[model samples]
Target: MSKIGFYIANLVKRVQNYSRFKNVFLQRLPQRFHGAARLLFYHTFTADEKKLATEIESFRSRIPALTTDKEIYSYTSPHSNTFQTDEAGNALPGEYVGSAAEAHMKTGSSTFNGILLRRIVAGAGVKKILELGTNTGFSGSYFLSVPGTELVTIEGSDALCAIAKQNMDRFSDKHRIMNMLFDEAITQLLAEAETFDCVFIDGQHEQKATLHYTQRVLPMLKPGALIVHDDIYWSEDMHQGWQHMVQDPQFSETVDLFYKGICVVGNGSGTKAHYDIGEYLPRPEIFRKNW
Candidate 1:
């Protein structure tokens, strides 16, 4: 079966197995769009996905600081997390062998969203950060690392928001917080009449829409600020999105590591620079020696 076909078949099987899949949203979604429904189903799950949900939730629960530690770093711990080194202990490669996990735990991202976020947060000396796509509060949580770095993160799902809220309680008193859908968030942000030094765009993986968000929010960024897009290699569309943004002839650099993409917007003339910050952990040796 095709990818979307498999998803629909599995969904039907799930609905047959459990009443949970027969919800108003699920029924209405497919009825609204027979072809596009699979996109939603692709990310969401049927009854079988409960296993992943359980695993991911369990992993979230184990973390001491759910908001920052687990959400931002891609489940790799800072102290135990190793780095790349040359044959003479200089520098060569890296990997996230420390903690490999999926979004909901079936399969996690190998890229290290955590490390880059920390480095940039500290390096930029940004006093405030606005994060898009605050999934489980992972990336947004990283804002806690910078002393007094205020955070305004947005997430779409109410369930995810509740889970993020629970996780964020650990660091609730530390940073500013805002969890809502992207559309509602744009309205809220505009109404607040506020702007930030940095904005991390990691929302829905759609290429054109993501680019639209980047463009719409450009004026909200600081003159020498930073805006990073995750999973540029996630799809051809995303790759195209990355390419389209850089084509404006306004950027100084663009970087791509297979897992993530970073774009920098700054300088007096508004040039752009993008980079793939290699491997976040650079510990391929662990898998070579162990796994």
Candidate 2:
């Protein structure tokens, strides 16, 4: 689109975002319209999603429960990471999973990756974790909340990285968060000869960028390492990136759970596994819960 068109579109969106009744643009005229307010939204959202707005109200009617640090990691393969976790759910050092973050979804990492992360951590007993794209530091805080864990989160925006660093500091003094964006930081991170138990990519939304980040971090992955990319259905770009990651021959032993796609290195034949983890939230006690 032209710059002027883009500007006008953004203006319209902003106006709609703050408007009383809501007025959304329909790029193409619909074959049928139930009502003025019921027209299909822009390319980003479909008519079926209108139910989500109503579901939020019903969700608020019930109190949310917490998913603890231990409960988070119980989902990982019991044989993969190997830890001495108690029955109550404890992430023993050196056995953990890592996850990515996005700008708009605050505390989403906990709700999404928190349980799986702790389970993988406890299972693998992973002592170190690497994360790309630290926004608001909620995911980083969740990772740090694990028992005896060390983490390194990288972000391109210095301002955002600084905020993440502060949040990480609040949880634990041992983490190392970097301010460089992933594009530039990948080289520096690789140069350090670091090998993490878990490598997470949750930064840019573009397909090519996500692929680039994956390849850039490939050499940094140790044996049995797990890479997580968030928001598979957040956009077409994201879904395309995730599809490429799983279908391409370069990687195998993968899991595509719609909301989050995981790439595994080493072990197993070239078989691919797909699951429906459905979108989930983090344990409320360990991390802030998003309403």
**Residue range with the least summed lDDT across 10 consecutive positions in model 1:** 282-291
Best by lDDT: 2
**Candidate 1 residue-wise lDDT, 1-291, digit = tens:** 455775566556544534433343345331322222232223334353344334334546443433332333222211112323335432212222323223433232211345345445665577778887665655555555346778877765444555555555554445444555455576678788778877877756656556657876666775656676766655556666777866654444444433445455555575554432222212111111111
Q: What number of clashing residue pairs does each candidate have, in the order they appear?
A: 22, 21
Which stretch of 10 consecutive residues in model 2 shows the poorest summed lDDT? Answer: 279-288
Please identify model 2 stretches exceeding 4 Å from their true place: 1-113, 267-272, 276-291
Assess candidate 1 and give its TM-score to the true structure: 0.56
Candidate number with greatest TM-score: 1
Error of 1 at 74 (Å): 18
Q: Rate the local accuracy (lDDT) of all candidates.
A: 0.50, 0.52
